[model samples]
Target: MQDHQSGHQRLTLSDVQRPEYLANPYPLYHRLREHDPIYWDEEMHAWVLTRYTDVVAVLRDPRFSSAWGPVETAWMPEELRPQLEPALRAVSRQMLFLDPPDHSRLRGLVARAFTPRMVESLRPRVQRLVDELLDAVQDQGEMEFVADFAYPLPAIVIAEMLGVPPEDRSQFIVWTQDFGRLLDGGHLSFEELLTTLSGIADFLAYFRRQIAQRRTAPRDDLLQALILAEEQGDRLNEEELLGNCVLLLAAGHGTTTHLLGNGLYALLQHPEQLQLLRENPSLAPTAVMELLRYDSPVQLTSRRLTADVEWAGRRFKAGEEVLTVLGAANHDPEQFPDPDRLDLRRTDNRHVAFGHGPHFCLGAPLARLEAEVAFTTILRRLPQLCLATEQIERLPSLVFRGIKALPVTFASVLPATGATAAAED
Candidate 1:
């Protein structure tokens, strides 16, 4: 372990201690991706995997394990260890943290709900929500792109599908924020992690109560489907059900929020692309895919080696931890030409914004639908939208690339309480 105290290394561990790295890790990632595509982290006892070919390969390879791992002390400073450990353990309990067979089973449980047909069914309702939200912004003259638009939209949609009442939607916001915070991995304290764990515990307790209610009083909702699934012998015990519910809600809210935020931010940054989207509403789908490829919200993913294996001309021992820098890979010049520039019209954009292989995001259909509706509606309705502030703040999260606040000015808005702004900044 080199300089285990500060968690810093010259070029090896530069990202850990550099504040600039948190802002835009691309330059650092480029250095690591091009030079040391695979390097051992002595302090963390892990390998950093950063390259398009290597990342995509490892994600598809069955030898890497998302779940199997022995618990240990945190690789960071002692003070950060207590908080980091519990969050890691709790996250490991989710399906994202599971290996095959179990991963297949857990994923299959909610797979039907997010399929193309099911997600498509929500289109009319999604359009209505989009219209209602845009209607409110129609007269406001200014809108906080995140608060007034992106963040709340996905939560509402997912909550409706999950059988949560309209009034309780705010609670999901709290839980999702806490969930995102723990995974951010940049500025969280041990105490903050414990506090967030309490939030998760509270959410689980509520979910258990909801599950019992659904068991007795079945309704035409996804939660009911999950409950009745057990009666049909597709049993999901309390732990799995609760864990999966949290997983769905968090993923449902998090990624979609990023897709909308990142996509919209890209539009604001590039006016011609925004005009291109406005000129051809039919281009929304491709624009969304390009946005994902250009600046993925979830920047990277982590995996552990289950066996000794050779990859990209490097050998690794069993039980080694590896970090796959997906954001860097999506922008790899080898994969996408002139990767730094945003090409809304870019075809053949098969980037792994939702990941690849068996662990591919189950909620992809829903995410795509949500993003399509959100981005298209905004461009069609508020074509004159522009940034109110030149400076945009980002959440200090390495795993997800998203804006903390995005203030913008629009020409006008429609009358109603449908658009309420809650800019945290």
Candidate 2:
């Protein structure tokens, strides 16, 4: 509960993990944005940026590099270094952690497959998946939203997009959960680090098999597209290919899942906003944007300084780490008036929920389409939907914000005619 008013010098990232802050961190975010926009946490040894302008500046500035490998492992204990080396090596190549020419090259190749037209073409299928998912639980008066709907919708969509067999979809649910824990940038217990590494190993292995199969028998899916993607005779190398594929799968679904859960929970909490969305279905697009702004799934992203620079009157040295608190930035009062309030029709959002600049989420279009379809479909189908319990458990990672489980009750509704058949097709 340390705050600027309490004479605390600085608030550590660990402070946000307390039950109260974990459930709702906006209050803390407000305090940071207002009093300590540029804070240096002695524990994390990183400068924390909470103000909207500062966060956006760091994200767009090339001086703040995205290459996190050296920063992440520099202080690691020698004993745990070897244990995490393999995982670190794989992550270092992923586009998310690369900088400049490497990131630009990798992103360009992948962008070809994720064009807006490509994502739009999948709407029908995404809609069908949403219908089928809801139809399964429509008969029951209650269901776990995260397990039944939120997780599967995007997971299946991304898996299908990658041409993964339906049977293999279940495995990713487990793998991605483990991979997510590694993204938090917090100190991990030895056991936790080992578990994350195991998941990373398995995920890369699975993609390796897919890559091999696609090399011989190419299909008309993203995996095959990625395999064949070329630019000026430059193609993704073996490790880069596998690393980015794993990134696509993990990032593709994990954040979208949280968007659905967090967005829905936000709507439910603000019943007026929920009613507004339900009444005016056309507001789906704006409503989705507002939801993303209100409670971003990805709360924080880190960057290592490429060169010494003075920003916001503070001189930061080269190689220093900076953590941009996106959640806090999204709610900055200077940027979004009455920032804490949920307004579905709010405009000029320009929120960094999916991030900003080159490292902006490549899967953003697809995520938005999936959420638009989901929120619209949920409201249309489950008119009586209400939280089964007020007590909800949020995922532990500070990097990703999400509800671990969301049990809800609603009046049972039968499947729409042919909805089940269409989904199965």
User: Which regions of candidate 2 deviate over 4 angstroms?
Assistant: 1-10, 69-87, 230-233, 414-425
Report the Cα lDDT for candidate 2: 0.85
Which lDDT value does model 1 have at 270?
96
State in Å the error of residue 340, model 2. Answer: 0.5
TM-scores of all models?
0.88, 0.92
Best TM-score among the predictions, by candidate number = 2
On lDDT, the leading prediction is 2
Any residue pairs clashing in model 2, and if so which?
none
- Native-vs-model 1 lDDT? 0.76
Question: What is the lDDT, from 0 to 100, of the residue 273 in candidate 2?
Answer: 93
lDDT of 1 by residue, 1-425 (tens): 22222234355533633567666677777777666778776644578776788888899898988884665554545675554554445556678888878788877878888889888888877777777778877767888878777877888888889897756767887888888776654556767866777687767777778888887888898888777765666456555667777888888887888888888888989999999998897988898889988878888788878889987667888888788878888878888898888988999888988888888888888888888877876776774789988777776676888887888887764432222221111
